[model samples]
Target chain A: MQLSAGARREGSPWTGVWAVFLKEVADHLSSTRMRILEVLILLSAVGAVYAGARTLQQTVSEDPFLLLQVFTAAQDPLPSFVAFLSFFLPLAAIALGFDAINSEYNRNTLSRVLAQPIYRDALLWGKFLAGLATLALILLALFLLVVGLSLIFLGVPPNTEEVARALLFLLATLAYAGVWLGIALLFSVLFRSAATSALAAIAVWLFFALFWGIIAQLLAQAVSPYDPFRPESELRQAEALVAFSRVSPNTLYAEAIQVLLNPAVRSLGPVLITQLQGALLGSPLPLGQSLLLAWPQLTGLIALTLLLFALTYVLFQRREVRA
Target chain B: MVIETQGLSKRYGKVVAVEDLNLRIEAGEVYGLLGPNGSGKTTTILMMLGLTEPSGGTVRVLGLDPVREPLSLKKQVGYLPDSVGFYSEMTAWENLAYIARLNGLPRAEAEARIARVLERMGLAEVAHRPVSAFSRGMRQRLGLAEVLLKEPKVVILDEPTLGLDPEAAQAFLQMIQGLKAEGITVLLSSHLLHQVQAICDRVGLFHKGRLVLEGRVEELAQRVLGGAYRIRLGASPLEGLQARLQALPEVSRVSLEDGEVRLEATQDVRPLVARTVLEAGAALHSLALEKPSLDEVYARYFQEVRHAA
Candidate 1:
């Protein structure tokens, strides 16, 4: 065989990304773990929407954004739809991604897959995108279910502003889920064992979800000591607390949802008495103002997701394919 | 050459995995890389596939640099790793289809090639059965089927027959011979000498991250054993038989054990030995000539290397 060196071919690094993405998405959707999480999220969403709509129907009041309230209004035992989502969305995202890369290593498939004519970039991106797409599909279904239930119970069609705010809320929720997915993927790449990666992802989630608030409070107090004699110290300490807590993705998601879902949420930080002067006390802010208020939080969630994914990409590329 | 490497080396921190290696394999030949585990055969294969970067030197496969033009190199080269794995939940066809897609085969073409390769590997009967239910031999065949899906010009198999039973290992060797018959350049790494000896055209022996020996099997046996044949003579009146056989022109050495005369000869001296036995009035019970076995060649070469060290 007379063979000469062919000219260097510049095939795109994304050559096989779509194939990987399709396979991963199929695996995630068909998995039993995802089915269980889907059932849990669906039940909570139905229960929360039922309770919130019941409450709204009893109250003979003129609330323009009654549809939005179905997501935020809490009953005696059941938290609102948004609350349920905030609690379970991270778990769902982590479940989809915790074993993404490590399972390939465990099964001894990484080397075989890498041996194909594709860059490592394609595999990592494909897995991450598939995870994000799965989360989006589930969240979208849940949102529509809540909306349909609210319309039936409250006998009210959501206004344009309500629909817009709800859409933004959904986007923020997806970004929130993306952050946890990124965390799970990063752990999956860092640890060789699937159990270890899952544990590490859950540890991160628990820190931000349950322990971060207390830790942030303590840190703020230590940084800005409160003094009874100086009233301004109280405001300074509150500012410090907000700054410290915002580092957690959970805090960012919560703040973003507050502004997006609750148009009456004027600010996320301490408000001075003078700053509230001449403001319409009871009126809801316009959709634009609400989005502007939540812009920093929304961007923070996206940045955290990107940063985590970038770190995972670098680590996975540098890693050896051998098990 | 289909695959060539010059001054190739790999070091993992303080430990040298492969050091200053030069290897060349021609097209349409089955080249066996023989080594015990951790002798750098797998690492060298990885470097050639661009799956692992070499710490020094260069590799070219099918006239393309594995590092600089990996996609092009990989498209023409198929690598079946040791203990190869697939998504067990997926069917045999699904697993192969995924590999075909990664090679950027069109949907119809991918399906066709998958069907063809599965049939070729004798997996057509269970094409839709999940791989988890497959036995070890079946999985190894499926691994080969995956490699053949690309219709590669060169195929590299690492420890392809490691855990197979004797019957299955023999069957796998026949498949490798089939590949060679189709003019595919094959590089297979294995520690099992006799099994691969039937299929490999040439072999390189690896020891402690170095290519200690490389040549045809018979040539290696000649160089290491100092002769290629062992002739055993069973004769009555074994007295003076050892010195007599030792003095023969064709024989290199002679020994007497268990009332039998054993002689290492450069060629077949059976006729001469028989004539001498009859003239001496010795009854020749059984006389046999043994071709040099690779197992013996490997053992003797290592023994010599050990003694030298």
Candidate 2:
């Protein structure tokens, strides 16, 4: 009688999201790829931090922000902690997300999973949230490790401003990771083969990280040729270059980190000589001013992440599951 | 009716995958969708499960519209897709547990039901082993166990016994019969006719996106073959036997093959043919009646369609 009347209660679209999220997190934690990436990041962090502390102790022992210097200071033959992260974080995020959806197709499990009493929204959201949580866990542990190393090397705890700035830097890093995760997820939905999606995600990363800066420089020069007679032309050229480079997420993340970890960074754009005439030189800005300077780049990264994820959602919902 | 589709049609661009399929299946009946590959059997199944949207018409499973209420419809329908896959790294129990959680089953009840289904599927001994180590037959049974975990009212299987050996295919069909015994409606699709013919209470023959014929297997055989029985006779002297067999009132047609006479008739004509052979002064060596087989029916139906086209 109930079947004839069709009075079955409808379930929510998010009914099974938590279960999917937990299972994905467990899989990521136990996977060999995550283990390899964790070791790679940890080794680079320890090496960079040790080198940075040695250089900072010799050069800036009396600085007020000695704790922050440990993150920015770099010795010869090695880059700073920020540089190492900018290079490795994208790879880590890509590893977590490149095969997220296509692997389900490859294994022929997509239809079986979708046959349950849940919507496709739950599956996609669950996988994305799980990736972000895994990235957050790794980044948080790395942050604590760096701070503890700073305490041992500098022989002083960080001030409130320094801790706040460092936390902002951590948030920016996570957002940067999210951008790459979105790209990987997008490619996973667009391509049915896992290998093709993985390669596509890596290709996007490579374009932004290695080639985008040079391409921007060339394009800006072509658009706004420099003229010696008019110095304003040089400024216009420089502004064009910055605008073009900002389209790349790598550029946005790098600028945000520079302003958050180094308090002396007061402006992200080209500044005139008259603007700095009355300002004290080499003095650190307050935490609020530093955050204001990095706000646009920070939001840009988050927006890009959201845009890619939306596109991926649309493509995934339209995909045929028979493959 | 437990499953009904009215004028259901699906089109991808200009290609019509399924067209104007009007199907109705009653509760607890084992209905077979019989066709060769690319005949739209799988496409129809996908529409019924709400995995693919039909370009026209409607589908109702257990009185719930699949497109409008997929969540509730899917909850009561168990689907075993062709070549069903699993998380090979996880144990069979772990995989089924994930499905249980998705179904919103409580932890204790999920565990108890999982154990029961695994045991009934003969997978209890290997429940803790990773699915990568399972053979093809074992994996299919595991897929069936996963389907059973939901306690669904209707089970739709797409090519359930596709690649199994003869013994395993027989065992699998037995399990399908078991589902029918429990008063569950089953809809299975397969290109292999004879395998499904043994179990289906009623079958629909599909051709080029259309249900060309639908009825009970015996009825289909009568309609396609033009007769339900074929009688074969062997005698010492086959000269006048063919003429005598053809002259009988009940026999429709008679042909001589391999020194024996074959008769196609509407009903049992073995006794009448034997009497005719004896009356002709020929020694009766062999006389046997053959039931019409699904293979013959399917082949003959397609031949007629080709001729008509």
| Docking category of candidate 2 | medium
Q: Please report how far candidate 1 places residue B32 from its true position, in Å.
A: 0.7
lDDT of 1 by residue, B66-97 (tens): 77788988998999999899999999999998
lDDT of 1 by residue, A285-312 (tens): 9999999999999999999999999999
What TM-score should be assigned to candidate 2?
0.96
Local accuracy by lDDT, each model: 0.91, 0.91
Best candidate, DockQ: 1
Clashing pairs in 1: none
Model 2, span B37-76: residue lDDT tens: 9999999999998898889998989998776688988889
Report DockQ per prediction, comma-separated: 0.69, 0.64
